[model samples]
Target: MAEWRDPQWEYFAIQSLRGKSFGDEWPTIPEFFQYTVERFPDNSAFTTFAGEQRESISYRELAQYVEALARSLQNLGLTAGDRVAVSGKNSPYWGIVYLAVLCAGCVVVPLDARQNGEFHKHLAEFTEAKAVFMDGDLLAKLEEAETEQPAYRKYLIQSRKDFADATGAKWETMWQMIESRKGDTTGALSSLAQIRSDDMAALLTTSGTTGNEKLAMLSHANFTSNLIQCVYPGLQEILSTDRLYLLLPMHHCYPMTAVFLEGISHGSELIFPRGLAVQQILQDLKDGKVTVFMGVPMLFNKIIQGVLNKVKAQPAAKQLMFRLMMGISGVSDRMGKAIGSKLFSGVLKAMGFDHIRILICGAGVLMPEVGEKYRRLGLNFIQGYGLTEAAPIVTLNPAGTSEVRSVGRLLPMITGRLESSPELSAPVVSVRGHEVGELCIDGPNKMSGYYKNPQATAEAFTEDGFLRTGDMGYFDRNGYFYITGRSKNVIVTAGGKNIYPEEIEELFQLCSWFEQVMVRGYREDGTEKTELVVYPKLSEDCVARIAADRDAFLSGDTVKDPAKQEEIIGVQLHREILADVQRISRKLPDYQRIGRVRVILLSLEMTTTQKIKRFLAESRFAQHNDGLLTESQDF
Candidate 1:
C-alpha cells in the first residue's frame, strides 16, 4: 500500500548461510569475526570522537589487537574454560577484549560497570573468574571487595583516553601490546581450532526484573544464530557502511549482540559517543551520520514529549495544522500506507532525525501509541521482546513490514507457546480471539542454563522444554506477538478485573505533565485502589510562577497568615496537576481508572539498566511517602 512497505519478506534464519558458508552452520563468534576480517580488512570497524579529534581502527587493525590481547592473556595463565570477567563502558577495547577472550578459548563474563564493588565481587566469586578487565576506578573497588586474591591475577585496565596514537606514544597501551607484537599471531591461532560452537562464550547476569540475579550461559552458536537472524530479510536493513551509534552499555545483551556483534558481522562501522552528556550524544548523531538508533522506551518517550510539547505550545493556527497532519498520517499507517514518511519529512529533519532510518526500542514495554507517534512522523520505529537468556532478541519488528502494536514476528527457527495461568497477579486479557498466557519459547538462541544455579535453571523451563519467559503475551491471527506486561507487574482489582499497569501507564504517558509514572494497586482496609506515583520535573517558568504567587499572597492582607499563604499556593499546584490527571482518566474503564494521584519530588527508583524496580517502588511508597508533597484522591 506504500512505497516503504514491502509485502514480500522471506524468513531468513531458515535460509541462513550457516551450512552454506565455510561448510559449517554453527560457527563460533570468533569465527564470525574472522569472516568479517577476511572480507573488510581495511574498513572502519570502530570509531570514537573526543572533543574535535576522531580516532578509529579498521577491521584488520581490530583483528591484530584482538590477537595480541589473546596472546597476552595466554602469557598471563588464561586457558580454555577459565572464567574471566569484563566490566567497562562501551568501547572498542571492550569489543576487542570480548573477542580475544573467546579467541583464547576462555569464557567471557560481561559485568555491569555501573554496578558497585560488592556486586562485582559476588559475580567474580560465583564465576570463579581468575582474571578481569575493568575501568581503572572500578578495578580498585572490586579488588578491595575481594580480599583473597591470588598473586598472578590479570587485571587489564580499560582507560577512557583513546589508544589511537592520538593520546601520545608513551601512554599507548595498544601499541605496547598490539603494535609491537604485530608480526606474531602464533599463540592465539592454535586455540581457535579447539573451540566449538556449543562452548560457553559469555556468562552474563540477568536484569533481575523477574527476581534474584542468575547467570545466563550463552554459547557461541547461540549468539551467532541470533546475528544471522538479525541480518536475514524482513529485519533491520543495516548496510555495511552504516555508522551505528553505540551509546548503550555494551555489557547488556541488547547492544552486545544486536548492535556491536550484529553490526560488525555486517561490516558496519561502530561509532562510540564522546560521552553520555546530551551535547555529546547530539554531536555524535550529527557528526557520525548515525543511521540506526537503538534505545529503551524512556529515551523515546522524552523525545516524543519534547517535540509534541513544543508543537502544542506554538501559535494556535500552527498547533491545529500540526495536529491535523498527524491525524492524517496515523490514519494512513493503519491502512498499511505510511504516507507519514513523506508528510513529516520536514518535521523529522528539524527534530535531528535527518539521517536516522531505523529506530529500535527494547528492554521495556513500548506503548503502542508511542510507536505509532514515531511511525506517523515518518520514522521506521519498532519494538521487540526478549531477555538476557534469549541472546536478547527473539522477535523484532521488521522495517516496512511491521505491526507497530505487536513486538514482531518470531524469528525463524524460534518457536513460542502461551501457557494460561490464573495464579499470576492479574487475570489475563484475551485479544482478537486469542487468549493471553505466559509466553514460552524454544530456540537455538536460548541459553544453556544459569551458571552454578541448578535450582533456578531447573525451574526456568517447562516440562516440554520451553523456557519460561516470566512474561505474559498473546499472538494475533497474522502471527505477530503482543506483550501485555510482566505477569508479576499486573494488578488485579477488587472486582477481579485484570488491569495491565503497563497499558494504564501508557495512557498516563500521553499527558505531558509527568516525567515518570508507576501504576500499582494498594489496599486500604478491605478493598484496593489503583494509584499513580508521578514524578514531575518543574519547568523554570513554573518554579518562578509559584514563587511569585507565594510572595504576592504573603504581602496581601487577604492572606495575612504566613502558613496560610503557603497552604494556598500548595493547594493551587496540587489542583492543577490533579485536574490534568482527571482529564486523562476518562479514557479508561471506571475500575481501571486511577483512584488516587500521589506526586513525589524524587524519581521512581530504577535499576542500572533503566528498568523500574517494581518491588522497591512498592516498599518505599508504603514505608515513607515522605516527600509526598501533594495528593488528590477519591476514597
Candidate 2:
C-alpha cells in the first residue's frame, strides 16, 4: 500500500490530546459511531424542525438502535460483506441506516435519490447491491428495476405506504420490519461487535464530471481517518457545544465527511432545514441558534444577497453605521484575530448569524467577493477543496489565518506534488505551489478503487499510483491551493491560447443581474469558437420597470412620440452585463474574451447545489441558436 502523509495531523495531535483517535488505521463508520457513543453518551445527537419536538438520542441510545437494526438485517438472512444500498433525502433515519449496515458487517451503497433513471440504473447495477432501502417515490422505479437488475434480492420501503403489488419480488416496509423484531436481539449485537476495522464500509460513487460516474470503494479506515482529521485539527473551536446547520445534501462526500460524520463524531447537535426553501433556511438559522453553517457557493450567495437587500433598504444613518462597522471588521480580519472586537456583532445577529463561528463553503469554488463580504461581516468563511474519491477532504482553510483566494495549506498525511504528465504533454501535472497541472493525490482518504470495474479503477491512477483529480490547480508560496478549472473544460482557441470557462463565469458572478453563467466553446463552422450564455435573475425593480414599460406601450400612451419606446431598459441591462464581462476579460488573453453572449430571460437549469449543468445549457443554447449573440453576427 502507498503511504500517505498530511502535515495537519501533527498539529491536530498536539492540540486535541483529549479527543478519540482511530490511530493510523481507519475504523468503519460503525466503530466510529460506537466510539463516540462510549465517549459522549449523554450528548444530543440530532434534531429536526417539526415543532420543538427534538429527537435527543444519546450516544448509548443511538448505539442500541444501530444494534437493533443490525439484528433485524441479520435475521433477514443478510450475511457479512453483502452490499446494502440506501437512497433518500438527509434525515436521522438515513444516518441510522448507513451505520446499521456497517455494524451488520455489510458494505453500504449510498445513492442520490434525485438522479434520473439512467443514472439510477447504472449505480444500482454497478454496486451489485443485494438489498435496497428507498423512499416511496423511488419504490415505483425499484419495481421496474428488479426485472433488469437480477442481483437485487430485497426492496425495503422507507415510507408508510404499502406496496400495491409485491408478488414476484420480496418487499418489506421499514416500520413493519422493525416492529416485528421489537424484542431485544442482544446475540445479534454480539455478532456485530466481532467485525474489524479493515472491513469494507461503503461504495461511494464519484461525480463523473469528465465521464461516467464510478463507485469509489472505501473501507472503515478511509472514513474514520477523514473524520479524525477534521475533528482533531480545530477541537477547541469546533466542539460539541456548537450547533451545526446542515443544508447541503448529505449523500455527497464533502458534506458527508465534513458535516454529518464530523458532527456525529463530536456529539454536536445537527439541525436539518424544514425544507430547501431559502426563507426556511434563514428562519432555521435564527431559531436553531446554529453555530456552524456549511453550505455551497449558491446558498451563501443567496444569503448575502438577502442581507445586502436589507442593508440597502435601511435608513441612511443605519446604512452608514453598517458600512463603517463592516470596514472595521474587514481590517480586523486582515490584521489577524484581535482587530474587529465584535463591533459588528449586532449587525450579524440581525442578519441571523449571531452564533455562527464558522461558515464553511465547499462543493465548488466560492467567489472571493462573497468570501470578503462575510469576513467583513465578522463571519469565519472558509473554502475547502476535495473530491468524492478522496473521502472528500484533502485541503481546507484553517479557521483562522486563511488566505482569501487559497484553499488553505495541504492537509496532514496527504502528499501532493506537481510533475509533467506522461500521458498529456502540453499541460503539466500539478504537484506543489503555483504551477498549474492535473492535481494528483495519494492519501489514506483516497478510495480503494471503483467497485467491480477493474478497467476504470486502473485508469483512475497514474503509473505512479497517484489519484488523478482531473481538476486543474496550483499551490501558492504559502501552500494554499488555487484551482483554475477542470482540465477537460479548457477551451483551446484557433490562436492556441487556453481559456477556462470557469474563470470567465466567475467574472459574471460579480454582476448582480445574473444568477448563473457558463462560457464554453461551440462549433462555428469546423473551428471551435467561444460563446457566453448567462442566466440573469432580474431584480424585482427591473421586472416591474419592464412590466410598466410594456403596459405603457400597449396602452398607446407613447404612440404620438416618434421615439422608438421599445423596452430599451432590458437591452441596456444586457449591455451593462456585456460590459462587465469585457472588463473582467481584460485580464485574460484575447481569445478568452466575451466574443459572444446570450442573456437568458429564464433561469438556467442547475443541480441541487446550484452548479449550472453545462451540457444542459449548451443543449438549450443550441435549440435557441438564432437568438444567441455571436461574433459572426451583429450585437
Candidate 3:
C-alpha cells in the first residue's frame, strides 16, 4: 500500500516516529512508549508523592523496568495475546506492570482497585486471564473467600518478603520477578515486532457490577488515533515540560488514556498523588508544579464551592474587589486576552491552583457555571465527551475558544450524525432548531467491538458502521455537541412527550444543598410524571435552617420523639426542595415540570468513577422503606 498520511496523525511527535517504530498506521502502546523514551531519555516520566518523600523515574529507567518485567512474564509461560489482569491503586508500580503486559504481547486488563474480590474473580473468569498482578490486600481477600477461587496464577504487587511474612503464603512479587530476570536476555523485545496497530492492547469492561459485563476491545489504533486527534489541530496542547496530575483511578479509561498515555506520548511528567484527600491533592499540586489536572465533575464542584465559600467569608470590600476582578477577567478573556491569573495571583497561590495550566473534566456532566467560574479565575477549563466504547474521547472543547453550553467540537477525522427513527431504540425529536437524536460516531477512535459478545457488538453499530453512542443529544450550528441524557433514562409522559432525566437533573445542580439528585418517571394518579429524588447535604447550617422552618411542629412531643422529629424534617425538606424545583422548572415547557419530590436523608450510592448508579438506587428504593416517599404524597 502506498504511504497514507492522515493529517491527524501528523502531530510532530507522532510524525517523528513514522517509518521507524510506527508505520502508516498508529503505533502500538509499547512502540509509542519506546519512541518517547528514545526521544527524551533523561526526562522524568513518573513520580509518586508519598508523605515527606517522592519517588521518581525517568523515561529511560521506566523503559528498562518495563522490558525486564516483560521478559519475566514471557518466561512465566505467558505468550502473545494472553490475558493478564493488573489491579492496584495509582502508583508507578501499577504503570510499570500495565506497560509490561503490553510489552510482553499480552492483553492488559486493568481491574478496578475499589471492587471487592468477588468482582475481581468474576472478571478474571470472564476474560480467561491467565495471570494476575494485584495489591497484597486484594490478593488476601481473594484467598480468604470461602468460595472457589479462579485458577489463574497470582503475583503480589507488594514486596514478596512482607506479604509472605504476613500471610504465610509463598507467592512471588513483581519486584522479585523483575530481579530474578535482570540482565537475562529474553526474546520479548524481538517478539514485540509481531504486534500490530490493529491488535487488541487492552480489554476494558464497561459494566461489571452486573454479571453481564460488556468488555470493549480497544486496539492500538483506537487509542493512538484518539491521542493524535486530541493533541493536534487545536483540540488540546500538551508539551514535554508539562506535568500531568493523576488523581482518579487508573483503571478508568479517562485517566488511563487522557493523563497516563497522553503524558507518556508527549514525554510529560506524571504526578501520582498520595491519595484523593483534598489537602493531599492541594499539596501535591503545589509541590509537583502540576500543569494539567483532570477530574470528574463532583471534584471540580467541591473545589469551586470551597473557593466560593471562603470568598463569601471575606469582608464586604474584599468580596466586592474579587467580583470586580472576576468581571474584568471575564471581559478580557472574551476579547482574546486573559489577566485573571495576574490579577488573582495571590489568591491562586493560596488556593493551590496557581501552577495549574489546564483543568479538564470528564466521565460526567459539568455545570456551565462551574466552567465559567474557572475561566473567570484565569484558568483554562474545558470538558470532553466520550464513553468506554469509543476509546473514550470523541469531542474536546478547544481551550480559549471553549463553549460553556456545549461539550466540545468533534475531533478531526471523527464523523458524527444524529439518527431519529425506528432504527434508534430511543425516541429522539426536534428541539430548539436542532434535531435531538442518538449521537452516532465513525472514526479510528471507535472500539473494535464488545469482546466475545457477537450479538451485542452487532447491535452497537449502525448499518453504515457508526457506533451508536446510546446518548441522546444534538449539535449546535457552530459544530458544538450537547448531550441531553441517556436513552435508557428517558421519561415518557401521558401526553407522549419525551423528557430526558439528564436535562431535568442538570437544573438541580444550581441547588447547593442537593448533594445528589436523580430524576425519573413516576406513576401519579395513573399518569406518568417526573419525580425527583434528592439527597441533600445536611450541614450544620442547613439543618438549623430546616429546624427554623418547622418550629411550630418541633415543640414538646415532636421534639421529645426522635422518630417524629425525623419525619417532620423529611416532610418539610420535601416541600422546600420541591418549591425550588418548581421555580426552576417554570422556565421549561409545562410537560417537563417536576410534579413530585422525595427527600432521602441518606446519600445516594455512587460508582467508583463518581457517577450515580440509577438502577441501584431504584433497586434500593423498591426494597427499603427508610425515608422513601410514597406515591400518595404527590403534589
Could you give me the TM-score of model 3 versus the true structure?
0.90
For model 2, give the 10-residue run with minimal summed lDDT.
Answer: 560-569
> Which wins on lDDT, candidate 2 or candidate 3?
3
* Cα lDDT computed for each candidate against the true fold: 0.75, 0.69, 0.79
Q: Residue 578's C-alpha lDDT in candidate 1?
A: 71
Enumerate clash totals for all models, in the order shown.
1, 15, 0
lDDT (tens digit, per residue) of candidate 2 on 413-502: 777875443333255433343467778888778887887889988978888898888777787776778877777777766655566677
User: Which residue pairs clash within candidate 1?
Assistant: 18-25
Error of 1 at 52 (Å): 2.9
Q: For residues 189-292, could you state the per-residue lDDT of candidate 1 as single tens digits?
A: 42453777888999988886545778899998899888776655667777787878888888889988888998877788999878876546767887787888
Give the candidates in order of lDDT, highest first: 3, 1, 2
Would you estimate the TM-scores of all the predictions?
0.87, 0.84, 0.90
Off by over 4 Å in 3: 1-9, 12-17, 159-170, 185-193, 207-211, 421-428, 539-579, 625-635
Q: Give per-residue CA lDDT, model 3, range 486-592, as digits (tens).
A: 77777877877888888877767767667888887878678878877877777676466555644332223233343553464555665566667667777878888
lDDT of 1: 0.75
